[model samples]
Target: MNHTRDKESILQLYNKVLPKLAERIYQNLTEVTPLFDDFRLEKIVDTWTKDRNASTDKEISIENGNVQQLGLKLSLIGFQAAGAQTFDLSKDLLFSLDYSYYEVGPDKNSRWMEKPYFEEWTSKELDDIAVKWSEEVIDEITQKLQGL
Candidate 1:
C-alpha cells in the first residue's frame, strides 16, 4: 500500500466529497432549524431585550418567524505531506469555526468570537474529525432527506 497514494485518495475524497457535505449540512440545518413559536419566541425576544448593555444600538431582523441575524461562520482547511522514503504519507486537516453568541457585558451588550470548535483538536486531528463528521452526517441526512 503506497501511503502517498492514500493521501491523494483522501484529499480527493474531501475535495470531491465536500460539496455534497455542504449542501447536505445546510439543507438539513435549514429544515431542522425551528423558528421560535409565538410562545418560544417570547423567550428569544426576552433574551435579546435583556441585552441592555449597548454602547451601540443595533436593529434586529426577523425571518420566517425567527431571528434572521443569528450569526456564525465556519471554515475548514487542509494540508498534507508526502511520506519520506521510509514512511507512509501523512495528511493534516483543520476544522475552523468562527461565531458570536449573545452575551451581556459591562455595558450589558456584547458579542465576540467564541472559541473555535476545533480548539479541542490539533490541525491534523481536526481535519480527520471534520471529515468523519461530514461523512456520517451526510449519510444520515441523505436517508432522512429522502424520507422528507
Candidate 2:
C-alpha cells in the first residue's frame, strides 16, 4: 500500500533481473551467429537503457545488418548462383548438324539456410528467459520482505 515501497520493489525488479535476462538473450543470439557468414550481426547485438517509466528501463536492441537482407532473399527464393547463365545455339538444314549448350542454374537449396537468428530466438526464447529471471527476483524480494 505504500507508494515508496512499491517504487522500490519495481526498481529492484528492473535493476536485479532485467540485466541478467538481457545478457542471457544476447548470449543465445550470439550462439546462432555462426550460422551466418557475416559476423557483423553478432557484434551489433547489445543491451541498452531505454526511457520507459523512468531512466531505470533496460532493453535488448539489435542494429540492422546485411545478414537480415541475405536471410530474406534466401527465404523467398533460395540462393542464386553468382554469374550463372544459360545459352543455346541451333541450326536447321538438310543433312546439317545442330548443337546446344546451357549452364547449370543456381542451387535452390534453401534448406541450407534458416530463419533469421534474431526472429527465431526472440520469438519465445527471450520471453522465457525474462520470465525465469523475474520469478527469481520476485522470490528474492518476497523473502527479504517477510524476513525469511
Which lDDT value does model 1 have at 72? 17
User: 8, model 2: CA deviation in Å?
Assistant: 0.7
| TM-scores for every candidate against the unseen true structure | 0.22, 0.23
TM-score: model 1 vs. ground truth? 0.22
Candidate maximizing lDDT: 1
Which candidate leads the pack in TM-score?
Answer: 2
Clash counts for all predictions:
4, 0
| Per-candidate RMSD, Å | 21.0, 27.6
- For model 1, give the 10-residue run with minimal summed lDDT: 36-45
Tens digit per residue, CA lDDT, model 1, 24-61: 44443343223211111101121143123334444432
In angstroms, what RMSD does candidate 1 have relative to the true structure? 21.0
| True-structure lDDT of candidate 2 | 0.27
